[model samples]
Target chain A: MATMPASPAAPSSDERLARTGPATRIMRRPEFGAAIGAIVVFVLFALVDSTGKFASLDGIARWTDSAATIGIVAVAVALLMIGGEFDLSAGVMIGTTGLVLGLLVTEVGLGIWPAILLTFVFAAAVGAMNGWLVVKTRLPSFIVTLATFFSLQGINLGVTKLITGTVRVAGIDRGAGFDSARAVFATDLWEPYRFRIAVIWWIAFTVIATWLLTRTQFGNWIFAVGGDANAARNSGVPVHRTKIFLFMGTAMSAALVGIMTALRLRSVQAGQGVGQEFTFIIAAVVGGCLLTGGFGSAIGATVGASIIGMAFIGIAFAGWNTDWSFLFLGLILFMAVMVNTLISRRASAGATK
Target chain B: MTTLSEAPVPTGEKILELKDVSKSFGSVIALRDISLHVEAGSVTCVLGDNGAGKSTLIKTLSGVHEPSTGTYEVLRKPVRLSSPRDALALGIATVYQDLATVPLMSVWRNFFLGSEPTTGFGPLRRLDVKKAKQIARDELLRMGIDIRDVDQPVGTLSGGERQAVAIARAVYFGAKVLILDEPTSALGVKQSGVVLKYIVQAKERGVAVIFITHNPHHAYLVGDRFFLLNRGRMMENWTRDEVDLDSLVKAMAGGAELEALAHELESLGGAAASAAEEVADVVSHPTRGEDTR
Candidate 1:
């Protein structure tokens, strides 16, 4: 072999930064623009909505209370999406889980804790099936989850009818330890603040999801599988396992939300979560998650839920017809998607350069 | 630099030995009776054309697929590699053409994709970011790769740099046998040279390198022993002392067929030259070179 050339001297930090150029400049701070946009929105809303309810602690608590449930589900969906899969069944799985729990404790006379554990298991099994079908058939997750979504929706209605003789399952409040379970799941953390327990769970979920997506070995697999399935598989990342876990996570998160909702209402309805799937996905996308996968944060999704919460409450507080909420949401979704698209393009392009 | 004669006798101690390994996809035999030896600290170049079962052979070695017949040995011990994990545990790392790196992920993240180091208390533990960054930088630097930041996504690096990172990662993970699939095929001239340098570096570190490529030029540059495959069969095996660059290129390019094509082209050129000369007086010379001018 020829004599090895003298190793190129390492560049200094400044020189290295310069080597990054504009593309690296963008990559060095992929989320800076999004952060700025969030800040701008916060400021804009804070300024325009200086009215009594807008600036009051009551309004803050109410907005957060509204944001909490959606945020939890959105964070979980974000993780699943990052793992390069989608879970359309997540929203409906909530109803299934709550019904199961409601039926278990109220009708079957089972203990609350046992019912909760069994519901989680059932949710996880549904998730595992979703993942298995997707991986084994090599089908698109969008289609796979869509099928599961419809199937679960049908089951939610059909099973609720079969068990309760109606589309609603009630009498959950009559069970023993109902008060304790309600305190655990739906208790207001701060007195007079009316903050729901789901808010704490949502925040905890955001923190945990963020940690799982960034710090853990599982996080690495999530990115790998989403980023490139073949490459991840070649690297021995267990692509199938990662996707399955993500699906399970999505379902479990939905189940948790379902449990909270059922506890808060003391009843489970078949149609309760039928239309919330799109809302969760929109929040996730707005929070900077790429629908194509491999890039996102749980915090971003939480922020997205906050944005949605703000628009919903702000419009109503302004005395505008709340019917415009959907229109406003659609517009926000469009803008968020556009912004995320640009960021993703810049991120991928920067990496290539 | 040690000359070939001054270098220690290789002792025929095969680090990885494949004996009559065959594989088939349906009725088509992808590889048949392919036997080869990879010695420690030596580069074993497997040269082949587009469909000569180069991929099949590598997949078998990397545990992506099991060989249908024959025996394979690792460090002189016959063992079956059932999965990619098995191959990795056996200290065999395969760096494919795509390099198995997530484009959007940081260089260090890609470097330690599956095996990440963590530190802290309990389930709330964090990745050892400093250590991971330091190791990625050091390992790549040792391989003569001078990337700006390990924090940058691997996709930002040049193709050659990416290949170097993959090689460095394999070495850091204690890989005794490194399998590289067409590491140079997708690179430019300068980039190819850079990757070749890393291949030599790995070889110098006593790692048995399996350099798979259709490019005989690359094979000649780093290969200590060459195994040539054609039509899913082993055409020839040559030690460094036995083969020259020209012979290797010819064999890869279909020796007699290339010669025949060359002869045909040469004959056609001669005929064209004679015809041009005959028409020279009548034709305009504006397109001709200085001699005509």
Candidate 2:
């Protein structure tokens, strides 16, 4: 018998190995692709702006208002993505929540504060139900949430017409506490440009979400559960609870956006926010959230939302045919995902070497 | 080089003992009358071929499955484990091949995955990123694993490095009985050597290492005792002194069974017969075959 010699690749001075440079480190970030995409799109829109105001403070306000609403939900959707799930009902959830608030104020004769609070509760309950069905049935969240999306679409239209005798609910401005609710959710800031309060909310929410994803224990569990559910379970991570909470978060964010829209307009149509689910998911994917889950950043989702918002406002300002907007979006999504995959592959390989 | 003519004796305390353990999955008996005890600071190799109940034995030991009939004692105290977490609490960690680490996550995150150490108080408490990174780096280095960066995803690491990370994690988390399910089965020769070195290092750290592998050469390299399993039964158990490399290989290769298979192949004649004869030749003269040992 021969005694085995120790492994030759035993710990040597790793200092002799190449250290990762700042550029490589930055490139390896999950949000790197989104950040680059955002810059390029911003430049493209600024160059093509026919009104020239597309690069001004007024233009910033207009695009930010658009981005803020999408950003809020996209961030939460990004979190859900990182936790390995999807919420297709998120867009329709806004309509469900808006209609719920509309009825509570205009029909139920409740104050704006009470109606807004009740709408949040309704949305949270629905979100929890979406989560419960996903976890219990072990069905793809796509199928389960799609079921929810269709069900809520029917409810939003059917219930609104049933109660108001019209597909749209109005006259919410007359409800008690309407002024304070509007100031908080839909009020504008700045003297001339008038930035929407939702912009502030978006920034604040992004900060909170970023912190939750990077600094906390729940954040780690999110990555683990998304990356490998079995490994997470084996490591004693609470996979079910994390996923359910992620669903609740996306729903609640939708409610916040819904309430903001309702208060700002003082009315809501039953079909409001119908197809916005794709926009939210598109923003997340563009922002560097993997469609398969287990990787993303809140800031990346925010940047992704900004890209969509810019595209919407910028295309109209550029006097181009707005009909081609979706085509542009498809191209951006493809390019962003391609860039992200390529960079991540290169970065991982480089770091290992 | 250390002396190889004589077998090494394990003189440490018995840390884990399984007495007449048997596990059944409804109608199918996975493990039967499996009795083995592991000593602290020693490597116990469980050698078997495919479908030889090695995975069942690892699962039973790691608390993933409970024995239908047997007593499992840890440090002389009989305990029934409800889950892997329970086993973890008792310092028994099982590292499963391909299921050990989250591939996309950073090395530091995978290191402190389930039981992350947090700083601050109340809701303000967060993962101690700085401290976690430092400790993960130190722990891997301690185990002779020089990772390029703690922030790199585990998927970038070679197969052997991933196993080393899992082993380091188990060791850091106070795993008394380390159950590695075929840690080297998926690795190349050099990579297998890397893992085998860690097994010895883990044993040197006074860990009761349970190294599972199909390769007898790997077992002979570090194992202080050997348990051969066949069809869920403990076919043989031997101390290092009672076994030699040649007999160990012949026994694992199924001494008489290989001869029977070679003869059966020879009946095909021509090229098949010549190939079978060569195989028979190697089987008859084991030293003339691959110097895997």
Candidate 3:
């Protein structure tokens, strides 16, 4: 019942009592609590893993190496989610992009940069298809992307066997421009520690995604479309175009991860990146994104990826079974959701009064 | 005494003028020849029933749909508002009953949603949070809405408060012609009064307001000019001086038809009074026995 009192016609004592201070007036963002939680988790992990390997530069590099790939994908997925859509084909897209590049280089005798460009174009085309199907058909993105996922999965295995006569494509390092491309994608930044180039790409992606989601006009459209598509459309926002852009962005991110992985391994495996869509979504939701959309941050998605990376490494370092990682991820996702729900409830309740 | 010549000029003075606007979805005509004018610095109330063309009229004015055949004028210029952005550019902002705002977003964020200001050095430019919060607070205060915090999600506010916030936003964003669709139709008596006060505030600020509602009392309270619509057609267009409250109410309630129906029902009830009294006595005695038992 501590409500904002009605304005008085004359100056009154009640008016003075009801006035709130400026410091107390700052609107509470949903990400604030999540940021605090991330910091606390980081400190806790740092404290408990006091062993030299856990605290060392090598350990930091190892954890971040794992965190980067997931972070990149998660950020893109978060944008798509905020734009009120989903891309189930994101995970499978990695295999498709890598396979496409592999075929282009070895079978088609194309150079590395052309292969990369072609792969990106293919990724964009696939993304466009997803967007076109979703918009034109007026079908749920989940169903549309699921269809794309299965179709791409089939193509990945079928095409690799047809081109390479094997389930994997190797000798990418022997291709033209291989040395320079590998230097850019797979090079160890620190010689002794072997910190990956992918980690840099991940951080860069996070920065760009955060800027695009929070600063640009497109970001506003994304939030509006996710929050209420009908309303956004009525308000003159191009909801369909924004969603299409989001879908394409996600596919491109997955393709980038695929290229990095193929370069790092110097091989393209048809089975790579299958069944990992849920992980990207889980990471985003744990980082303080609502599955319902309209509220999430790129930084939060990165933090969520970091948490996943930490847990994966930390548990292994503790000598626990790596298979238990899924269980731990599920538990963390539940806890994060519970905490987020409570914070949102309190924030809304505070606003009402 | 006022002469018809001295009456308000029916010239190019309308901020928003809809002429013979009609819309049809296949064979069903949703709206038919709905001609209305909303002048600057005044409230033109559009009254109607559930199936009436109120929504159609709103959609047309707000640029959701192009009228099948009618001219729409803004600032006396006949222009086709193909999109809501066009309407907004012309300083015509519509605050629908549902109010286009993300309930989970902070009041300040919702206030400056599509048009957030930014400040800072290159690559470090961020939302002007301080300015946004201050402006949101000031605008709401101008509308007589004193909130405890500008940071709170707008969803937390009451229905009336949300409507007021939307009005405040429209006014702050240079909305010269504000179209509010059924703003107070969902509120309680006290809440409706609060909304009406803000509507009056918008008028006092020299903004032309198109207040659409079914409530005659609420409309009469702040509306300078009333345009009543029934079945997608204008029933009566009257100024404050021309029509009294009773007449306005009567017009909205279908005037002669409503009065005739009331009279007929009254006579029918009086004729059945003796027979109804015997039946009521028998029902009352049985009810009394049941209650006693």
Query: Second chain only: TM-score per model?
Result: 0.85, 0.89, 0.84
Tens digit of per-residue lDDT, candidate 3, span A38-87: 67666666665645476578877888888888889999998888777888
Better model by TM-score: candidate 1 vs candidate 3: 1
Ranking of candidates on lDDT, top first: 2, 1, 3
What RMSD does each model have against the real structure?
Answer: 6.0, 4.8, 7.0
B1-293 per-residue lDDT for model 3 (tens digits): 11112233332256678888888888888888877887766777887767778888888988878989888876566788787877787777999888567666668877887677788857676677788889999999888888767866677677778788888988888888788999988886667777888888888777788998887777777878888788777778888789776666656555556445545555568656555554444333332322211
lDDT of 1 by residue, B96-120 (tens): 9894688878899999888888888
Residues A132-185 of candidate 2: C-alpha lDDT, one tens digit per residue = 999899999999999999999999999999999999999989999999999999
Worst 10 residues of 3 chain B by lDDT: B1-10
Candidate 3's docking class is acceptable
Q: lDDT at A289 for candidate 2?
A: 88
Model 1 TM-score, all chains together:
0.89
Q: Assign candidate 2 its CAPRI class.
A: acceptable
Residue range with the least summed lDDT across 10 consecutive positions in model 2 chain B: B1-10
User: In angstroms, how far off is B215's CA in candidate 1?
Assistant: 1.3
lDDT values of the candidates?
0.81, 0.88, 0.78
Pairs of residues clashing in candidate 2: none
